[model samples]
Structure formats: structure tokens, C-alpha cells
Target: MISTKIPFVIFKSFFNGSIRIKLDWESLISEQVTINMSFFEELENPSSWYLPWYLNDVDEEVSYLAPNARQLTLADIPKAINHLNSKRRDKIQELLSRFINSTQPVQLVIATYALPDGKHLIMDGNHRSSALILAGVKARLMVFEMFGPLDPELLPDLRLWKD
Candidate 1:
């Protein structure tokens, strides 16, 4: 489940009256992608959604969506944020602040799996996994989930990209 969060937009245009479309969330991240961080950042701006370099050339493997069972949200800091300091502290704080100030819901990605005992395990989305701690989100996640653990023998060959 590829849940990349940002501001959610709800409005109407002459093309579609009374329509609702959630602007792709630009702050929340569930899966990892190799695109340049700047490229992703540009997508957050309404004007950048159509740029050719935005989402440019994504790997097919990165397209998998995670199920909600194999994920969990810990109250502690997200692993990605624990290392923040002067360089990115303000940016992170600003992103979160803007999100809270917006009138939209937060987005997240979760990886889940079922157990023989009938319990679910969420392997990801610690920042906001539980409802009690859920940010202003209507849907808890939007994931690009991958299947069972990879078997090296069944993996595909790698190829280099060319400009």
C-alpha cells in the first residue's frame, strides 16, 4: 500500500460539480522509492503535478501495496525522524505543522499480515497507526504492498538506466 501523505483537497470545478479528490499526500511516506527527493517535493506543489520529471521513471517493484495487517505504529519517533537535527528539523516540523493547519486528513501506509491465531501484525506505519493517535486522516493508509519475503533465487535481473 503506497500511502504518501500530504494535504487532501476537496473542491468543485466546472468540469465536475460537487466532486471530491484528495490531493496526493506529499508528507507521509510508506514505501521507499529511488526518485530524487527534490522530484517528490515538487509534486507537493499543485503546479508541479504535471512536470515530466515528477514521478519520472519509477521501478515496477516499488509499485506493490502493503496490506493493513503487517503494520504497526509505535508512540516513539519514526525511525526516519530520530536522526533529524538542524538541517532537517525545521523542514520536518514545518511539514507537520502545515498538515495540522490544513483542513484535510493525514495519510499513511501500512503493511499487514494475518496469523493462525487470528491476529494482525502491522509491519510499518508507526507515526500514526492507531486510531487514538491518528492524525487528521480519513483513511489510515494508501500502500504499495509487496508480497511474501523475497527468495533470491526467484529474483529478477537488474538493469542500468540510460539518459
Candidate 2:
């Protein structure tokens, strides 16, 4: 179950319109994709969506956290925030401020694909999602299953990107 906190009206429109279309992420990423402003404004509750990253209390390390590959909601934000240090918390605040002040549409890249359990693996945009939730702007995500846990490999891509 790909946990998503989408509004009823947008949900209806999403299935009925081009808002949520399935596309290849590789191709889609090349083109500039922006979430519609209406989508953000219509979110009923931004606090109910799930996030993908969490901090481990034992070693104080950050891990890619999820429940049975299920979605995490904004309701879970406080716990994640609480686990973070002052620096990380401050970053979230900065993102919230920028999101609130910007009139431009928020740019995002939500990598979606199916898991072995037949669940959808929603990856990327972890911090931005949290920031949006904190800013109280909600939007339904359009999921595209271009790849699973790995596209070119069998396990998670442990390699970090370098620009």
C-alpha cells in the first residue's frame, strides 16, 4: 500500500485529469516538471503524509526509513524533527520559510516504482516534502513506477551522486 494523503476533490480530479500521469522517470527528469499551484492550495491536511528519511538514535546516523515500504505522513514529522539536531531542525525551518514566501510552483522529483510486496516505493524529495508539510501546503503526488528498489541493479543504490 503506497500511503498517500490526498484530498478527495484532487483525488477525483487526479484520476480524471492529466494531473497524475504515468511516465518514464529518466525521460521525465530531463524536462522541467512543476507541481500545479492549485494542487498545493487544495491539500486539506499536509501533516498526514509520510516521509522517507529518519535518524537512528543509537548511532546518531540517518537512515532511509519506511514501514513495509508504506508511505509516511506529516503526522510523523514531529518525531523525525525531534530526533534531529539543532542544525537540521533549523534547515527545515529555512525550507518552510522559503516555501511560504515563494509564489513560484515548487519543483519536485518523486521517484515511484513497485516493491516485491506489490507496494509502491516512493523515493526522493524527502526534505522538500517535509518542508511543504511544515509550511501547511498540501498536494497530491502523481506516482510513476519507472523502476523498483533498483533499476540497473537488484539492491538499493548505495552510491551517492556527485555533481
Candidate 3:
């Protein structure tokens, strides 16, 4: 069983002035192939803000939190999806198949911002996360706690886009 006592380590500081937390999930699912989170580099200079393309039309206001990251269980998945404002059924099932049939473990980098009421607004990786829930996989997500406006231009240090 994966220990819930995992310590939260402040990983590194990014160009956009945000610190990522280094989480150790190696022991959780040893059979799964580990893919290091590399989306941070792509976010440094995005040609278009549409990389995390799903949020383009979302009009909700996002709240900020201090840099925080933690492990979320399979049970927490549904609540996170609820923040998206719409349940995407087809997209989740499609990703679910990819997750179950793949020979290698798929590393999903789910990012979310904290809501004022202590809820999370999943900014990216919703489909993958939902699929993981359906697959009954307990995974560690690299959830970046964001602050400020949702506008790409107004985001802190041009590090607004997520995937």
C-alpha cells in the first residue's frame, strides 16, 4: 500500500516564479512506467496559449493559494471534475480505454488551482483524471496551486498555460 505519510518537498523554482513540489510515487505502482513531468518547460514560451486548450472558453474566476501540492486518492477524482462546470462523458471514456489498454503506465500531470471555499478547479488533465478514477488507479498528481486572474497575459510571469 502507498503510504499516506509522504512528505511534501518543495521541488524547484520555475522561470515564472512558482515552486513545484517533488512527490515520490515510485512505490505506488511499480509496474507502471514513470514519466517525469516535463510540461513546465513547454509553458516557459508557448507559441499559443491553447496548449491546455480546454480552458479557452471557461469563464469562471479562479482563486489563488500558496504553492501547495499533495497526493489525491481515487475518491477525490469526482469532486475535482465537478469544478469543471460540465461533466465530459465521451472524452473521459475515450481516455479510459487508452489508460486500460496501454502496456505502459500513463503519467497524467493534473494541474489545479484552489478555490476560495477550499475546493479545486482542475485546470488541466480532467479527462485523464476521470479515466484514472474509472480505472480504479490511485495516482499522484503534480497539482500546481495557482493564484491571480485566469487571463494568460495577466498570469504571473507568463507561466499561465497548463497541461
- The superposed Cα distance between candidate 1 and the true structure at residue 35, in angstroms, equals 20
Q: Where does the lowest 10-residue lDDT sum fall in candidate 1? A: 47-56
TM-score of each: 0.28, 0.44, 0.37
Best-to-worst ranking by lDDT: 2, 3, 1
Give candidate 1's TM-score.
Answer: 0.28
lDDT of 1 by residue, 1-163 (tens): 2333322121111112211111112321232312110111111212111100111122111211212111112332233243324344354455556556656555554332222222322333322343213233333344322222122221111011101
Stretches of candidate 2 exceeding 4 Å from the true structure: 1-50, 55-73, 85-88, 103-107, 115-120, 138-144, 147-163
C-alpha lDDT score of every prediction, in listed order: 0.26, 0.44, 0.39
lDDT of 3 by residue, 66-94 (tens): 13322233344444444333445567767
Q: What TM-score does candidate 2 get on C-alpha atoms?
A: 0.44
Residue 50 miss distance in model 2 (angstroms)? 4.7
Which digits, one per residue and each the tens of the lDDT, describe model 2 over residues 24-142? 33443443333221222233344433344444534242544322232344566755676666775787888888988877655443443333433333344456666766676544453
Cα deviation at 146, candidate 1, in Å, is 1.0
**Is 1 or 3 the stronger prediction by lDDT?**
3
By TM-score, the candidates rank as: 2, 3, 1
Candidate 1: misplaced stretches above 4 Å? 1-74, 78-85, 108-139, 150-163
